[model samples]
Target chain A: MPRHAPIELEKFVPYQLSIVSNTVSEDIAREYRERFDLGTTEWRVMAVLARYDGDGLSARAVARLTAMDKVAISRALARLVANGRVLRRTHRGDKRRSVLRLSAEGWRIHDVVAPLARQHERAFLERLDADEQRALARILDKLLATDAAVR
Target chain B: MPRHAPIELEKFVPYQLSIVSNTVSEDIAREYRERFDLGTTEWRVMAVLARYDGDGLSARAVARLTAMDKVAISRALARLVANGRVLRRTHRGDKRRSVLRLSAEGWRIHDVVAPLARQHERAFLERLDADEQRALARILDKLLATDAAVR
Candidate 1:
């Protein structure tokens, strides 16, 4: 008789974490839709440009910040371009590479979303006191920085 | 001049954690692709059923376990049924409700994946030490158990 397979539901920490995260993200996406009329990726792009500093990173930086795929970011940026939420301009001396920036509407969206995002965060982290939230963020960032551990 | 958008990234601890979780899940998905012939959902479904009771839950339960949508799970279970990875049968009294259980091959796949999933988790959580892993798991489970906090 073969051994009974282990229960994966509670055993895999990563899967559990992902489940919680996805649930939280879906809530955020739904809330964002209600407030901003933007897709998840579109809002993510604007959020990235809100952090943009004329670094010419385009969709690459957005993906880095949001943990989205390059293809997904590219598609989101294309939509932004179509909707005039983002602008793509030639770099000062580089033709092949284009620098992407937020347009006026993108800024408007970001402005509207920032406070709501903060409130959402507050609601989600309400169970955790400030110190606990800070501690969790520190630990998560440390884990994220350790490539060998995660890789 | 438009006002500079507020910091979107720093506003939410849960949002940041979700992005970190996405990073880890993507890493796990990449690892699975390199080692298994199964797609992401296929691997997840098998894993979900590995520990599930043979009493057979509805496809919705499986979807919740796998974090997959009902339509997607519908399609995947259809494929799994055709491939003999799963047994989809209606209850004796109720034919409209389909109950799902793992077939032998599904069990085999689950056996193969358990260690791989654990390896990925052990490596990722190694940074936090065993005690910290337990702590993190407890906190995450608490959050997940809170229905309003989840999504």
Candidate 2:
């Protein structure tokens, strides 16, 4: 009988990607957590709102794009609204729809926050070189742009 | 007066990589959590133990590599030890070092667990053809190899 070979999670791309992504993200999140007392989800919401255009998300769009549930986005929006980092305005064309946009303070925080984020990103990507960053960017862009299949 | 411009998170390389990575990771974690009540830290411990090497960790290395804190690694290792998924053997040269390795069942679970993960990866990358995949692979390799300042 053949011996059952041992499995190493490092060989798995998803697992490896998860490790890489989460490690860097956790570092970023922790920094924000300590410096601004900002929750990760809240930061993400504000970040998204800061860049929103048009009438903004239809709840479904936010959920789909952010991979966050509608309920969670709704709750986060509520907090953002209260914190004055975001504004929720009714959609003129679609009465049922609401727009999410960042407030002035949100941009203030975002400018401060994003530069710090990039600094961390530079640190995180320090493992790779310039050519590698381009390569990684290409790969990431391709992966995100296409319809990911699981087979 | 200068008008403030909104920044899109999607335009950020790290953010894009994270979004794609997280989508697949969350799916796999859901499976792991459903099958066995494993959190991110515990699952990472399992992976590391399964891939143990001569330069054994002292909880600190694991914490550094996994981006988990020492306390979290300690707790996860304790759980893994109690669950019998990991075995700690004493180092020959260093008495202070306890070499962590996986048990037979641990290897078995790893074997079982990674296929689903691989499929997830393949699916995620399926959007890109061979050229694109190679391009992506090259990019990621470069990014991983260098760090990102080169660009």
Candidate 3:
């Protein structure tokens, strides 16, 4: 009987991707967590809100955009709302639905943290040369699109 | 005043990597979670142990190999030990540390699940062409190496 080859975790693409993603995430999370006391889900919520600054977004929309779990997003939103970092207002078009936006304080933090986040990304990408960076971007896009189509 | 550009989450590399990683992870998690009642960390621990069959590893070693948090690894180890899927034994050379390995039942499950895990990985990678796969492998390697050097 031919024995099956054992998986080398280091060589496994999914495992490698998870490690790389988590490392990048944890580094960024540390930056905001230390200064702003924000968790990963909370910062993600704030980021989406900051991008749609004026229009705001519903909790569902935020969850969709971030690709985060609804329960995690809900908990993050509740904490942000409670802490005055986010403002929740009834949607103009739908009375039952509400939209969330960064409060002035949230925007202030976003402005500071957004640049730091971008800087972190730039530093990480700098490890790869121009050609490698482009390849990574294209590969990620292809993988994401394929996964979406599969689902 | 010139306005600063907000991060387009869809275009951001880290954000994109995160979404892709999480989607892949969640899909695989669903498979094992339903069939084996395994959480992500538990499965990760099991995978590492399975890879190093016969030679048990310390929890610290598992954490380092898996790049998971020590606390999370500890919790998973506790649960696996309690469930009899893993056996904890005293180290031959170092009495202070206990080494962990999969039990007979653990190997039984690993044999079934590892192939499924590899299949999922292969299906995901098949989405990209051969060139794209090579490029992704190189890029991920560079990123992981860079991260290791930085830390």
Candidate 4:
């Protein structure tokens, strides 16, 4: 047995979301890429690291938080470390696990980028009303929760 | 003086949208990849072509519609044609421009996959209420419209 359904590519939620997200991300990435010399992957890793006031996160934790694979995280960390933006430390008790945190320079860059990121988000979101904004948030939250549950 | 604003990566709309969209896309892609042996790019081209009941579209039009790069569209189209899922025609008046349409086999694949895609969307949306669904749609529309306007 076969079933058929009409689907418009433009109206598909996943398609729409991918286009908008990619556009917004590329737009936002330009500033970071040009001025900060950071790629999106590096910025993502830095974003996670910037949040912790103290004590760095393990690579596994960063992977879990960012939804990026270990290879990407490792590559970004290498670049950040080489740029002197991220500081890597080995836990005293565990030699096997490495912890990562933003260096003073990393924090400095984060401080500069975070507000700009928010401003971009605010500007993009300005197209919608406050109610729409709230609803969007609620819907995303529900989707994320459900996605997690399904996985 | 430099201005600073606190930003939470998890709460950021762009980040959230990106994560959710990527997750949904990957989840949906698995079924098509496994069952139909079609990549995301190939599926996208086929989806667009399936909508046209008659005259086919050029690769450029497909790129515009799908937001995919020329190289990807070319590669996907090549694969689809090779797999006997797509038929290419040279217009009688214009020999230079080639038109693309799904083969009967392509339509069969689309008939099978489209329902699965809609089902995924439905299942994902089931977590949100009717109001939330409407609001999400409205918000996405506004964002998309604004994005197009700005571009």
Candidate 5:
């Protein structure tokens, strides 16, 4: 019988990345859900809008920037719009199209949530020494750039 | 007016981690979906079962091992069982509860998929030098351990 070596899920880089990302994301998502009744996708859209501020992004632009599925982004946008967290307006540049931005309420949430998100990131980074933190950031950049090149 | 700095999404650690993880996972998932018609959760459950091999794991055990939602795990198990890729038998230690293991077909799929998964990991790691690779692994361990401690 040929010996098949089992892949150790714990040591698997991709699996580890997934778990770590999911954990961090879930923790942040929990805060958003509990405090603001925002789902993961919705909060992500809000975050992008918060970043863009006055320069509203099209749904297509949001999808591209976030690298999220179009359908998921659309759904999140709908929920946000319905709940009055996001405002959709006709694009001034293109009358045929629309763009999305956070409402005053949305900015209020983003102002609070963005800082909280930063706090969580700081807490996570504090576990590592300065060297490890630098390495992690550099490694992620390389990996992300490489992945982006392929896509 | 006090200016609130907009988080540079591109530089944000958590957002970068998420985008990288999602890209890698989505790429791998595309392969699995195309080749084996497997969902991410299903492949994850299969990987866990393949690791255990003969000693089957209960659904709850699989959930714990994967750190996945119980509902998602259950749904994946159902799909696997329905597709005849996994076998569910009453636990030997406790007759009331059931345990899951890969069937012969499941093992066949695992044998093929495991190597493919390793290939993807290797390809991703090839972008980094030896030091970067080692640093990434160590950094992930630290981050994962710290995150785990909180939960």
Candidate 6:
């Protein structure tokens, strides 16, 4: 191609963000994957259920909050149930739909993984100072606006 | 789980970043996947090849640059070659290794896609102000430093 300027692959912002995301994900994935045999999707479900303390959430709600499709949420829910980490219960008002909550085992896993997850984030953020951390958070908010609007 | 504090899934920085990364990737992937019939890996290979001007790069180098494993690089290279967008040649000095470069057709695709890629970035960044953009870049640099050091 006759080009005025070649795109600098290294400096590309999307590419750089992707690399960071992948690296961080792989690092965290290895931890849960090995110890708990949890895939990324499963971990997300576990995290979500662990967040709420009461009657639990519907599959649709989990799908919406996680940005995962219904099919994926279904599959992960199945796996979580099979592993005895989450309980699929009949929804209080809607008998046809089931709400999901963490089982005792699920809570145990979440309690352990939560601290590890925080540790990972802490180490990762240690790379930047307080000002940079604030700046990063602000930047992410702004960047995510386009994503939120489009959705 | 009886918890000291539950990890807030929504407020977690890593999870937020993953959402943004996945959204941005999906947005870009749809453009090339529908129009160019290029999967993300194949497009990444094409972009890397399109960046260099001359003799081309080894598959090992491509893997390193792309953050993909050798097997993934090989698969992408095969698809690229089959589609007539890339040429694989035996290295001049080392017969054991092969170098890859974009063909004329590859350049055509790259030229077409580069602007689309840039447009996506511009549109995404427009959500942020100049200062936020600068901070984003700075944060990415800091985040990447740990990755580079570990590698």
Best candidate, DockQ-wise? 5
Model 1 lDDT tens row, B1-151: 5476466564456666776677677777787667755667777777777777669878888888776789988887888888788888897888878988888887776677777777777777887866566667767776777754444
Q: How high is each candidate's interface RMSD, in Å?
A: 2.2, 3.2, 1.5, 1.8, 1.3, 1.6
- Tell me the number of clashing residue pairs for each predicted model: 0, 14, 0, 0, 0, 0
Arranged by TM-score with the best first, the candidates are 6, 4, 5, 3, 1, 2
Candidate with more favorable, higher TM-score: 1 or 4 = 4
The residue pairs that clash in candidate 5, if any, are none
The DockQ value obtained for model 2 is 0.37
- DockQ of all candidates, in order? 0.57, 0.37, 0.68, 0.67, 0.72, 0.67
lDDT (tens digit, per residue) of candidate 2 on A1-151: 3243323554456655665676667778898889876777778776666555555656666666666788888887787778887777888978888777777777788777877887887776666667666667777776666635432
**CA shift at A9, candidate 6, in angstroms?**
1.7
lDDT score, residue A141, model 6?
Answer: 72
Q: What lDDT score goes with residue A86 in model 6?
A: 92
Compose the digit string of candidate 3's lDDT tens values, residues B1-151: 4364567888888888988998888888899999988899999899889877667899899998888888999999999999899999999989977799899888888888888989999988888899999999999888889888888
| Model 3: colliding residue pairs | none
A10 in model 1: Cα distance from truth in Å?
A: 3.9
| TM per candidate, chain B | 0.76, 0.77, 0.93, 0.92, 0.94, 0.94
lDDT of 2 by residue, B1-151 (tens): 2354444677675677688877777877888778877776787776665555445566766776665688998898888878887777777887877777777766677666656556667776776678767666655544443432333
lDDT of 5 by residue, A1-151 (tens): 4556567888999999999988887788899899999998888888888777667889988887777889999999999999999999998869966789889898888889888989988987899999999999999899888777887
Which 10 residues in a row give candidate 6 chain A its minimum summed lDDT?
A1-10
- Which of the predicted structures, 1 or 5, would earn the higher TM-score when compared with the native? 5
What's the i-RMS for candidate 1 in angstroms?
A: 2.2
lDDT, residue B99, model 4: 89
Q: What TM-score describes the B chain of model 4? A: 0.92
